[model samples]
Target: MSWIYLDNNATTKMASEVLDAMLPFLQESYGNASSVQHRIGREANQAVALAREQIAQKLHVKESEIFFNSGATEGINTVLRGIAHAYARKGKHIITCQTEHKAVLSTCAQLERTGVEITYLPVNKTGEIALQMLRDSIRPDTILVCIMAANNESGIIHPISAIAEICQEKDVLFFCDATQLVGKQEIDLQRIPIDILTFSAHKFHGPTGVGVLYVRRKRKPIQIPPLISGGQQENGFRGGTLNVAPIVGCGKALIMTNLHPEIEQYRDELEKQIKLQIPEIMIHGEHAQRLSNTSFIAFRHIKAAEIMTALPHIALSSGSACTSGLLDPSHVLKAMAVSDDDAFASVRFSLSKFTTKAEVEETINDLAKAVSRLRSSSPAWQLFKDGLIS
Candidate 1:
């Protein structure tokens, strides 16, 4: 009757446990983390240290390797820009896929203006890039390979482990945008060994405005020039008064993270029901490995905006929240070679751990009715029904 939120990829409701952990820092523990001379400052510093340790433990990384920032966007900018500047002498070439988040793509675009050579790899219909193509794209001058572990729109999971191995063999640094991968699955940096990774707390039921950047140092050190220059903080990697409350919240959120199988079941059931009840619907990335909680569906002949408008009580997304306001079709869908009409028709429903079967069932019914009603007034749908168009 009120709202059925299925936009978890855009952001999640902060977990009560995370909020509880952050309260003390926001109130009684409020002190300058940089001021270590006083007791309050020492307490703040200890909380930050504990939070960092918690995140490190969850990621199977060292505390010294973790750096906190505003969120994944800032971390991405920091990594791409820092690498471009820090490794310019080594090589000005970077390799990344076209489906990367706007943060990565835009940063690469900016670097291109500065005479940096960026190779944008193409992905197949399933949104998975050919590993051989990636290997071939890597030149002797390639300093870094940047990619996302999971796509935010279609939820397609790339073969990051293989990509890592290829980069490792080539002795090139790799940066993974794991914002969509974090908290949804277990990550052991020791096993996969990504050169650098970044994630946002808000993507995993933690507070907004906080994120982590993991820089590898066990095998070969990664030197990233600071993006923000001010007082020495985050080991001089990020300079600012640490966001004590959100940092504490982020750590607690990561510690409490766990895989939810039932959410996947709900998502699958929702998709199955929608397909069974409605005709001419296509599931994007259905054949590929994807995040369990995401479902991107395109109802042919019906615009995604119209669908969302029909189901007013449900929270849904046409594409990435960052790019939603733009009238163009989703770039992610376009990259997968989807028709422009289907790209415009696509809707992303990202379930959270809190999503329930009852809500999912209700949504199926509501969506089916909305689509049927809209299609009745649509000439395109009539053409599709008559087999005049597909």
Candidate 2:
């Protein structure tokens, strides 16, 4: 059986082009990027510089403004630590949404121990934060506002532009976690007044172990304390020897895959087919703008994990990878006011450029079969069959 992968949001298979680009660095040019005395070290440094340039170009920011970290988690930690430590005097209060990744939510939770106050803004039924709620939450002591550009579970795109405008009016620094949005959607930093942005390369078919954080240069002199204190690196914000190979691979992957249009086309076709086959399935974020390559659907009376286990030839997820093992419903869905039944029955299907229409059709057919089988045994369906009064 040919296994189809629909869990692009969890992590993507490393692109062949990305692996090819990193082969030299991994095998031949293995050296510390900070070293200047050896040829290998110089080559690694050069590779790191080039990757920074590529990421900067993508974000429409200066190369100096972009910093490489281990991944989105690390990047987010750095941002939280930096703002909490450097701007502690400015304010001890931060605001974020309840649906943010654990990386962001947990970081804020940790900050609370150090006298930082945090308010988790609520999302609407569509899993989106209202701009007015953000405006209402801003206080004189509000130092920063953090929100994800796209949700990992529902693939819902948040109104970062409107939030940015609100932040600007309040003179509050805004940090956006764009891990799921960076390469999947078009990002123009110039048009959006975001103070900080974070993304991981693996989300875009690049290798893991590399992520980028963009800090707006024009922001008020906010000092961010280092997460890893060491020799001068990442402009002293993050201190550690850079991983040159993965960074090089990440840059190449972004340039190669993100520029291709076929990925978008594939996603459109998948959405169309699934809707045609399963009209009763409720699509999360259907009413709002979302990432083109992602879809979240809940099959009534079918357990998501049951469907996943039954389709062993397919790789898919219920929600975020970080929360995969937990039997509880996704916090994202809960924040969107989704009922327990819908949350447990939802599955996320994310497509990449490599996902073929054949695979999509096969997936749809398999899903229909799985849902039918599960529903036949479901207690809810049995109750409906008994002709119980509505």
Candidate 3:
């Protein structure tokens, strides 16, 4: 059976170019990046440095600002926990949105247990935090404002530029979890003014286990204490022997990323067809600007689990892959004022640069059949047909 992958937001398929770029480092050139005394080690260090430069150049950031790490989870933890510890004297308060990834939310929760005050800004029905609310939430003690560039589930893009400006005006550090936005959108550090940002490689056809943490080094030169303290790996910010192969792969993947404007067309077509076939479905974040590769839709009376079980050949998600196994509804949908039933019914279909129009058409047919078949059996769906519920 042929498979159609629509879970790019969760992780993308590694590109052949990225694998080719990483093979040398993984096989013969295997050496500790820190052990530069030997030729192989020097070569490894050089490769890592080139990888950093590639990423920096692609993202329009300085080379020194880029630090490689395990992934976005580590990067988020490094920024949040590191700031909480390093800047504790300045303030004990931080602000973040309620729909943030588990990395940001979990880190904030942990910080709260340690006596740090955290304010979770709520979103509207379209998954957007109000700029006025954000401006009002800033207290004198607020040190950091954490928000993502794009949501993992709904693909709703927060007003990152405006949010950064607000944080700048308030003199608070701003950290953007751009894991879902990095390759899908252009992030020019020179223009955005975001103090810190994090993104993973696997989200953009790079190998997993390696990612970037970009800390602004110019202008105000924000510095948080090192999250890991060892023998000066990652400029002493993260201390461990570098995973050179994946880093090289990440660089290649980033450099190879070319925004596919046509992806939005495909996504729009899919949503249009899905809505025509399944009128009871509600498209989450439909009013807001979202990533071109994503569509989050909820069938009113059919649960997402039923749809997934029916369409086993399609690779998609009910929500964030990290929390998909949990019985509870998605925190993202709940934050957007979605009903518990709607949240459970929501499904995310994220495309990639490599996704073709034919695959999208196939997916539409599969989804329509699955939804119709499921709704046929659902008693609640029958009640809706009988005009019992809206």
Best by TM-score: 1
TM-score of each: 0.99, 0.95, 0.98
| Residues 1-390, model 1: lDDT tens digits | 758999999999999999999998888989999989998888999999999999999989899999999999999999999999998989999999999999999999999999999999999998999999999999988999999999999999998899999999999999999999999989899999699999999999999999999999855578799999998898788888999999999999999999889999999999899989999899999989999999999999999999999999999999899999998888899999999999999999999988988899999999999999999999999998899997
State the lDDT of candidate 3 residue by residue for 234-289, as single tens digits.
Answer: 77788888999999999999999988988999999999999788878899999899
TM-score preference between candidates 2 and 3, better one: 3
Predictions ranked by lDDT, top down?
1, 3, 2
Q: Flag the better candidate by TM-score, 1 or 3.
A: 1
Give the TM-score (vs. native) of candidate 3: 0.98
Q: Between which residue pairs do clashes occur in model 1?
A: none
Model 2 lDDT per residue over 1-390, tens place: 798998999888888878989999989999899996999999999999999898778778889888888899998998888888888777899999999999999899899988999999998888878788889999999999999999988888888999999999899999999999887777999899999998999999899889888888873565677778988988887888888899998888777755556666776666677777764578887888888778888886678889999899999889999988888899998888888888998999888877887888788889878877887887886775676621
lDDT of each: 0.93, 0.86, 0.92
TM-score-wise, the better of 1 and 2 is 1
Evaluated against the true structure, the overall lDDT of model 1 is 0.93
Worst 10 residues of 2 by lDDT: 381-390
